[model samples]
Target: MFRLQFDLDRIIGTLEREGWVVIPNALSATITANLRTACLDMWRQGLFHEAATGRASGQACRAEIRADSVLWLDQVAALPAVQAYNAAMDDIMQAVNRGLYLGLVELESHFAVYPEGAFYKKHLDRFRDDDARTLTTVFYLNEGWPQQAGGQIRLYLDADCREFVDVGPEAGTLVLFLADRFWHEVLPARQQRLSVTGWYRRRRSSMPW
Candidate 1:
């Protein structure tokens, strides 16, 4: 019942050809609703922290760059919904490693909440000092999000940042892209927005530290 809703072959093929893919209804309605409720409960409990940018010493909360709040999934891993989500991601990780040979070993995810007028400026997923992030995954949990409500993710297709695509923040929609390649950003929403954003990582021989 908690299985992923994506076509494994299609996902692999599209990512290989385009370096990115936006899949609608990537999760079942039951799982989506459970995850959404869990996220909201965490938010209400004040478990989220203001999102930051950069890495390690460079990490700082810069509202100018991003204004979302996040609660790391590990903090709520015991939750049934979170466990189901993790299991589903683990399946994808294995498939990707087998099909694309990305060498991804684990996934780290967080629940992100963007209040009204919140936005994240355009940026790539890989950090300047970190290259472990092999792939980026954004699983949206906003139910009944109308296009007019305005929280769309803008993905830049070319290095010149010209050609692009906009994906609505709809429930069960999942966006995947090569972490170091595409540039993307969240457009300001007229209302609140929610999502589980994560990165698939591979083992590194050495650390910058």
Candidate 2:
């Protein structure tokens, strides 16, 4: 009897104005804990990279080798709490695609781990001149993160570099925003700052790739 939950209009409006919105407790603590364990195991096996060579430059662990690569996604999808995450996204995309003819939704995801003094430079998540990549989502993984830890995302909502918003990397929080609308960066983390960031796209034409 668990119907889809979340305010679609509010989220869209917030994204338009603030450039981002964070949803708290998007996943249960139990699942987050299990996912942390799974990621740690993978980390021990050397399955991730220490850097991503692009708009981001930071002393952080990156796991961008695969979309939905985290073992926990598959493991917890069956759980109602976890399934809500997917369902909410599906609803968000459906609403976005309704006004556009033949637009398609595509998604890719990865994880980033910011250790002491780790950070990323400001950049847009999509390729310019292409409006197909509609949005981006980042899920954070770190319990009881401190404000002094300095792991916050600084989001830009203006072209002249005047407007901005800062979001913290609190555990079980998910940040979603339009991909092209903002330029953002992660502040240096004093401790381990972990997150899974990704994008959702819409095809520009027929036979969309």
- The candidate scoring highest on lDDT is 1
Model 2 residue 12 CA deviation (Å) reads 3.1
lDDT of 1 by residue, 1-209 (tens): 24888788889899999999999998788888999999999999999999999988889999999999999999999999999899888988998898899999999999999999999999998877678998999999999999899889999999999999999999999999999999999999899999999999988646665
TM-score of each: 0.97, 0.72
Candidate 2's residue-wise lDDT over 50-81, tens digit each?
Answer: 55433333323343321122333443356453
Where in model 2 is the C-alpha error above 4 Å?
Answer: 1-5, 16-19, 54-88, 95-104, 129-131, 204-209
The clash count of every prediction, one per candidate, is 0, 0
lDDT at position 110, candidate 1: 99
The C-alpha stretches of model 1 lying farther than 4 A from their native spots are 205-209
